[model samples]
Target: MRQTKIVVTSVEDDNFCKCRFCDKKIAEIKNDIMVPSAEECYKNGNVPVPNFGWFCSQACAVNYETKFDINFAKTKEGKIDYYL
Candidate 1:
């Protein structure tokens, strides 16, 4: 199966990126300068959707998914399957 790739880019200034759902500011840096996993990123209150943008929280992600009729399923191997 093909895994989903999420890329996180750093910003020069404080205005990093905005949440796609709530329009909240998401910081590019925190303390350490290491790439975080999707779960880690979501735990920090910012989930990066592949085609879409950043989502503030899981609630927002769910809201967006439901609103757009997008369905996400996790395989037995823990891979996410996205469908309409």
Candidate 2:
């Protein structure tokens, strides 16, 4: 017989929340509404990520995605574009 150990971490335990785009603390609510959820972090993103993603707006989400992936919002001016 064998025994295995596993560990899990989540952002829900954190005392402070931040904006995924600018890394700013989300201490204020806008018009009584909170920030966007993790599932809406990226442009075409539809899955929940575990790293506490709370974007203030859609533009912030896009900006954050662009920073993570340089080509996330690049144009196909002089590069080969492919669709699959």
Q: TM-scores, in order shown?
A: 0.49, 0.36
Best by TM-score: 1
- Where model 1 places Cα greater than 4 Å from the true spot, the runs are 1-16, 28-43, 73-84
Q: How close is candidate 1 to the true structure, as a TM-score?
A: 0.49
Give Cα-based local distance difference scores for all models: 0.55, 0.39
Best by lDDT: 1
lDDT of 2 by residue, 1-84 (tens): 333221212353344445566665643334433344222222232212233345445456566666787333223452211111
Q: Give the backbone clash total of model 2.
A: 0
Q: Report the C-alpha displacement of residue 70, candidate 1, in angstroms.
A: 1.3
Badly placed stretches (over 4 Å) of model 2 are: 1-14, 27-52, 70-84
